[model samples]
Target: MKKVINKPEQVVEEMLQGVVAAHPQYVKRIEGFNVLVRANGPTAKVALVSGGGSGHEPSHGGFVGRGMLDGAVAGAVFTSPTPDQVYEAVKAVDGDKGVLLIIKNYTGDVMNFEMAAEMAEADGIKVDKVVINDDVAVENSTWTTGRRGIAGTVLLHKIAGAKAETGADLTEVKRIAEKVIANVRSMGMALSPCIVPAAGKPSFTLAEDEMEIGMGIHGEPGTHRENIRSADEIASHLLEKIFADMPLQQGDEVAVLVNGLGATPLMELYVVNRKVAAVLNAKGIKTAKTFVGNYMTSLEMAGFSITLLKLDAELKALLLAPADTPAFVQF
Candidate 1:
């Protein structure tokens, strides 16, 4: 309810304007559309476009630069972008190498992005897509038929984008994207809910000493709620669920992402990562890389999500490859 904006309906539009203004050297708009593409787009390599509702900043948009996304479409807060919007993004970033759509598993996102793919194909632009179902928390959430993609989608962006930057063909880029989707898993817990600007109300509520575990990014109901627990306990439970879904063994290479949900502090996130790191080390799992901070987020929701990406040599090298984006940059 307490948002600093002129009007609720105009939030997405104004936000996109601000983003382009702040990073003109990195991205540009599609003119009267909620689309952001690399300032130097329409390149010779395969283009990567992904999007969903707004609110999760520095996601599809923040990753729009070299070694990451080529374009990103934004909808209303927690709302899906239309197929036309997505189609325009594909057109704007389209190169001879083709375009790849990195969609999360939400129903609207899947439908809209897939529709755009078909539309592009009709025009002879080769398009392929990979739906990320990395959330290990639930099978079917309110907005998705299967697992909802959460922070793990960012890892997919990094690795797959690096592949595309190498002048890889569309088919090969998609193959590497699928490989990341197959190996990544994530789970989240929230201490508080967020308020949508239009609604002027919190999406959900929790007691002062309660937290929702396995919650989706859009405030969907999670597996269960419990009294506030220690950070170690929470991290352990989340990892327990992750391993239950995909068991890992000694000497396994992996990457860790401790993502903040809007309002969670970096200090708290590092504390949680400490526990995550201790657990992986104790188990003899080799961590190739670890990222901590607000990579993906809800709108001022007090929570965090943990993501694990099982890595091979190819994945490790690409993940650590040089990327220059607004939100994420690595050498």
Candidate 2:
């Protein structure tokens, strides 16, 4: 219950205000709605909008900028935003080129974003969507049918956004997003549970020496739990699962993202990345680029996930394209 906030009900509103205040040049709030659109919105380029809950900061919102998302709708912590909010975002960001929605593979996210797209189409705004289900964890968990979207979604944003920035239409943008989804795979482990502000308690409990494997970002119980092991051992276990599922082979090039959930420090993330790179190198997979940091998060969860995207020439170029956003930037 040790949260630094004014009130539980006002948390999302206050946070959105803070984000707008902090990044006025890159984003602006749509008045009377919990939506953040790029400062220079309604551009002719295919607009990209993605969102879900609020706790995964610098995600759907932090990415609203050039070469990334054009708009983001915010829901309460770990809750899906309403279709009305999403519809407004589509309307606000759509220009002559239409809009694309990058929705994660959660049921609520899928349903809500679909409703919004339908509404937008009713209003004559062309819209398309791509669902990210890149987590190679488990299928048919209590929460979802297929895999859950995790750190791989960030790669989706970058690659799809780059395509859109280059004047790709909605169809092309969505196709590229799906291409990223098909090539990316992710797996995560949690050492400690996250405390949701409103709940005032950890979402789940894990013993001091235990870790949960194949966990989702919302603190849902993972596929299995085991005694905590060394960083290298943990990295091997995660990579083994991912590579088995994806079957990465020799002479393949990939992009690596070792993402800290929230509370884990960069030091530990790099430690995990070291082991991950060693594993990939031993497997004869060449990593063209590596990103080790908290790109995607689950509030204050103490854990991390690793995402690997098998890259082609176009994907590699898009992955290296410049992007400027509040949470991530590359030149």
Candidate 3:
């Protein structure tokens, strides 16, 4: 229950204030709401908005800038934002080209974002949406009906934002987003669980020498728990599941993301990436790009997740496009 905060209930509000203060040039708050919108305001192009619970920093909010999300709604730790909060984000960012909601596949996220979209539509705003189900770990989890969206959603954000930056229409932006969702697959493992601030206790427990594979980001049940294994073994186990689900073959070009859950060190993430690259190379799959570090995370959870996005020319081009955000920047 060791945490650095004044009060659990006030964590999200204080965090938003800090984020805006730190990055005023890039983002601003929606007055009294837990919403972050681009400081430059809405554009003539399609607007991108995505968010979930608050613990996964640098996600929907840190990604607000020139070439990423237009707005991001934040909820309590591991809880979905209210529809009104999401609606405020939509109203703040929507331009004539319309707004696209990049919702993860969590039950609450899906419901709340969709309700916001409908609310916007009634207000004469054109809104389109995409639900990301990139987690190959499980079919139905505690918070979602389908696969839970994990780090792969960040890739979707990059690709979709790049397309929107090109003045693409809403339909075109959503089409490209779906392409990324279709090609991407992710799976995660957890060494230790995180403690929600309000709860002041770990969400789950694990032994000193045990790890659970195919775990969701919110510390939900995974595929299995077993004695801790080497980095290579863990990487192989995850990659094998991905390959079985999608069957990546020879000559296939792919992008790899070795993401830290929260507490895992960069050294360990790079170790996992080394093994991931080896496995891909051994299968004759070409690695087009490799991203290592924390993209999406639980609240101080000890583990990592691997994400693979099979790439085509269009996807590769957009993924490599320039982006300037607080957490992710590409040139």
Query: Tens digits of per-residue lDDT for model 1 on 33-65?
Result: 899999999899999999999989977799999
lDDT per model vs. reference: 0.93, 0.91, 0.93
lDDT of prediction 2: 0.91
TM-score list, all predictions: 0.98, 0.97, 0.98
Q: Which pairs clash (backbone N, Cα, C closer than 3 Å) in model 3?
A: none
Put down candidate 3 lDDT per residue, 180-215, tens digits, no spaces.
Answer: 999999999999999899998987899899998998
Worst 10 residues of 1 by lDDT: 137-146
What TM-score does candidate 1 reach?
0.98
Clashes of each: 0, 0, 0
Which candidate do you rate higher for lDDT, 1 or 2?
1
* Residue-level lDDT tens digits of model 2 in 1-331: 7777899889899999999999999999999999999998878999999999888887879998988899999998988899999999999999879999998888899999999999999999999999999888875355437778888999999999999999988888888898999899999999999888889898789998899999999888888999999999999998988888889889999999999999999999999999998998899999989999887899889999999999999999999999988877889
